[model samples]
Target: MTEYSRKQEALDYHAKPKPGKLAISVTKPFTTYGELSLAYTPGVAEPVKAIRDDPEDAYRYTSKGNLVAVISNGTAVLGLGDTGALASKPVMEGKAVLFKKFADVNVFDIEVDADDPADFIDTVERIAPTFGGINLEDIAAPHCFEIEAALIERLDIPVFHDDQHGTAIIVAAGLINALELQGKTLADARIVCMGAGAAGVASMKLLLEMGAQLDNVFMCDRRGVIHADRDDLSEHKAQFATKTDLRSVDDAIAQADVFIGLSGPDTVSKEQIATMPARPIVFALSNPTPEISPEDARSVRDDLIMATGRSDYPNQINNVLGFPYIFRGALDVRARRINMAMCVAAARAMGELARQPVPNSVLEAHEQREMAFGPDYIVPSPFDPRLIDYIPPAVARAAVDTGVARTEYPSHYPQPVVETDRD
Candidate 1:
């Protein structure tokens, strides 16, 4: 199908089935008078009073424990750039759908038209009582960092910017498996990151937490390398700034063990890929189109492992693999925040899941005959049912271990479901 045809189909899918992609569904029946009374008025007031007396009781009596608020200011809707809040509704709703389908978590997509970071943070903090967790989406960098940090400090519930941590977690997981496949270690890998925005910065930080050395990592923004010499750097970007002589993507990619591209399409050339070290790993994760196409990268060196944001390619490093499961675990444990421990734990769980035997169901979903812990299969399929069972437990345990959990870990996690799983 042509691009125009696909675009039309997407519009039809969203428009034809009602005006939007999501709607509210009442969990309790309210057919009879007694049922209606219990759902509202007198019975509801009892729980309200109980929660007033002990705020923790709100989780027991209300949907707050299972509810996640997907809030976005829409300053940066994916690669679209500053599309504004109303324009980002569909993407937020799509995120809501993923939360429900992947982890059985409930999401209310909230789009706030606040341009100021302070206003966005305040708006989210005011509604903190209504949600178990907040998934911050599509707010641009520098401000996004400020918004998330301020909210995390102010709110007791978990506030995670999926654009930063979600992308980071999945990238770390896939990079772990890819490094293993190439017989390389994170500590030793000479890394080149081609974007200094949210995902690029966060992924590098997470890697540092996971044992990647600071000096081994080189970050690049549009203004070439993010080195110490650059004066016009945001505080977030400054964290990754190295005192390097390397000034260009070409200079950084030379002899690098890993090349991570979170930048625009076709920014990397086949010549750059050829300059990388033997058995290198490249994650060209720019959406729709990657910094370097998989074919172009592979044509230069067959020994290299490649991953992209596009699902049509092998070893796609998609954020869907992280956010749903991460939030599921955070909500399950009543985590005060999504700490680095939780993020690392989730990444470790995903990396370990990749090494396990591929279920026949997964192979069939991808229309493949077989799959294993190889170059092409470094990340678990998003449809893998085991993710619900595997990720949340690890994350919850990490939360408990890190002393961020408000409640004890549940004995019965990921309760069995009847629905058939698909990728």
Candidate 2:
């Protein structure tokens, strides 16, 4: 479809399906006055008094164990920057839909109109009791860092900014497989990352946590390669700043083993891809259009293992692969917070899944290629049903092991499914 047609179709889809993308549904029986009284009046009051006596009973009596709040401000929404909180509702609702569909997690999409970081932080903190976990979305840079830090510190629930860590987790997963395919290692990989915004900064940090050396990862924003001498760097950007003389994206990518573009379309050229070392991995993950098209990159370096944010390409590093299952695990175990161990476990599980035999369901769903554990299939298809079993368990195990879990490992999970059906 043409761009205009696609836009019109999306608009019609959202509009025709009632008004918005979400609605409330009563979980308990309430068809008669007897049920109504039990649902709201006397029966509800009993649970309320019980919860008052023991706050932990809220999970037993309510949806608090399963509900996640997909909250956002309008800033840095997709490629459409700073559209305002009210305008961000649709995206937030769409996120809620994903959370529900992919992992069976309930969500209330909250759009906070506050522009000041402190105001937004205070607002979310005040409403923290209603959710099992908080999925922060679309709120922009330096402020997003502050907001997430404060919330994670103050709240006992898992507070995550999916824009930062979701992208990072999937990027980490895909990078793991790509590096393995290319006979490279994260420890030795010379990395160049463009876009020092949420995804860029977070991906670099996660990579560091997962064994990538600090000195080897060179990060570049629109202002060029972030180096120690750059006095204009924010705290997050400054964390990744290296003591290197490299000043441009071009300078950073010279002989680099990996290039990750969370920046805009065509930001890097074919010339830049050609300068990279043998069997280089490039994840050009800007939405709709990538920093350099995979076709352009491959035309120069035939050994390129390329991934984009588009499904039309090989190894699309989509955030859907990470967030749903991560949250599923966190909620299942009643984890206090989503820590680096849990994130790494999720990434490792994803990478391991990609190496396993493809199931027929996933093969039929992904028609992009004759699928296998190869360069084109670094990460398993997002539709792979095994993800629900594989990733969440890994995350839960990490949560329990790290002592953040309020409960034991979920009894229903790690229920391994035999995938005998494959092409």
> lDDT values of the candidates?
0.90, 0.90
> Model 1, residue 422: what's the lDDT?
14
Once fitted onto the true fold, the runs of candidate 2 whose alpha carbons sit more than 4 angstroms away are: 415-423
Q: For model 1, state the Cα shift of residue 48 in Å.
A: 1.1
lDDT per residue for candidate 1 within 130-240, as digits (tens), equals 999999999998798999999999999999999999999999999988887898899889999998888998999999999899898999888888889999998888888
- lDDT of candidate 2 vs native? 0.90
For each of the candidates, the C-alpha root-mean-square deviation to the true structure, in angstroms, is 3.9, 3.2
Q: In candidate 1, residue 2 scores what lDDT? A: 100
Query: Which 10 successive residues of model 1 have the least lDDT summed?
Result: 414-423
lDDT of 1: 0.90
Clashes of each: 0, 0
